[model samples]
Target: MAMYALTEVTKRFTKGRKEVRALDGVDLTVADGDWLAIQGPTGHGKTTLLQLLGALDRPSSGSVLFDGDDLARLSERRLAGVRARSFGFVFQFFNLIPTLTAQENVETALVPLKVSAASRRERAGRALADVGLADRSGHLPAELSGGQQQRVAIARALVTEPAVLLADEPTGNLDEDTRDEIIALLEGLWKDRGLTLITVTHDSTVARRAPRIAWISKGKVSLRKDDRRAARSRAVTTEPKDADSAAVGGAVATAEQSAAPVTTTEPRDAGGTAPGGRVALPEEATAAE
Candidate 1:
């Protein structure tokens, strides 16, 4: 099943009396439980496109269909509900609160859900454990290593049990070893939780790990499948539990054969010249996470 279908999507921004078209007539479909890595040069549309996918920003003209609903037409309240219930996000910066303990930071994700304080703490603890930060739950972000802090950020993202995990430059701030560790953790979570994973990254090594890679340049996107990675995934998980599982597997294989350009160029910042700020969220929600 397709988790997201975007068609003719365009996003425009006004900066100092000039108009910037961030995304230009993009059409793409992301399958459920699919891991897609987006890469591109600086000042292109990678982050803009990701913002659209996460419902952090609306398209100027066209449909962004999550499941079957058109996000472009949804009210802000409806969009916020979708964000709160369906999507989880991780960012380049650890984005943890300076004063909050790791546990408290993870618990904030549940605040908008109206979870009781006790329930929030319990779930946050479990999330921290899942990310291998159980022992660091009481530590402040500054007390943890870079990798551990990212793990805490990951825990906070997953505490809500969202269907889709949207990450923007998640490993940009880490060293090579730490980056690999975070990538492995994310990969495991995507497979174990059946998440629809979409990551915007500037690292080619990270992009190659995904089953599908999407490259955006000059506001347009092109997609290609990573056949070698897909084959490896199939080999490791041979037995489909049921007919439905087998069918979905077949569909993914078929989709992989559809060709598009594959870029071997080194990844660039992709942050572009757009304005910088945290993702838009309600006051109670952590804007950066």
Candidate 2:
């Protein structure tokens, strides 16, 4: 059985007097322990698809099922539980807290999982060390370079030992030297930790690492199985422009995988922080004050 199955997924949103179709009738099944890469221009709903997969947002239509449970049916509380216990997210910018020490920042992601304070601290330290940041744990974010901080973020994401690592443009901010290092680290983790790594990137080199590729365009997703024609046939149900954009977070989906294409970048916070930093607490999530 597939680890995740998305069927007829459509998402749309409205912008300034314009409707954007971010995802359209997307269908995919990501099995366990698979390394997958999603490629497209910046605004082509790559990030939006990640959001849907991570259950940060529900599909406007269709279904996203984890194991066998439909994410749309999950309450906000349940979704938070699933995210905390099963998913690890890595954004391009290291989303560490400015005032917290590196170790403290990494420890934050573990809080939701109800790990004991002492155990969490120990595990967090080891995870940071794994990324070659053992000594910097006590330092603030400003003290570290961009690459160091991002590694700390990676450490935080992994400390929880989540089943899936969802990274969106994780290498976008680094220079060539650091970029390759981070990629190698991720690949190593993918192999050693046996994680399901799903990354969204415009870089062809990055996408090529994936064993399977899925393309999004219009309001549909095409899976590139053995036959290219079968992929095109799946798009017969693409939605109209208006409904398509507004539903999946407001951009046209593109099935044509571009090795590199110009994309209107999203407004990244100067701090590289995501919109929702705190994982909402549910009963299943262990939250400490």
Best by lDDT: 1
Q: Which digits, one per residue and each the tens of the lDDT, describe model 2 over residues 109-154?
A: 8887788999988999999999899999899999999999889988
lDDT of 2 at 54: 83
TM-score of candidate 1 on Cα atoms, chains taken together: 0.84
Alpha-carbon RMSD, each predicted model: 5.6, 13.4
After superposing candidate 2 on the true structure, give the runs of residues whose Cα lies further than 4 Å from its correct spot. 16-18, 224-289
lDDT of 1 by residue, 75-182 (tens): 989998999999998888878888999999999999999999999999999999999989999999899999999999999999999999998899999999999999
| Per-model TM-score on C-alpha atoms | 0.84, 0.76
lDDT (CA) per prediction: 0.83, 0.72
Q: Which ten residues in a row have the lowest lDDT in candidate 1?
A: 280-289
TM for candidate 2 is 0.76
Candidate with the greatest TM-score versus the true structure: 1
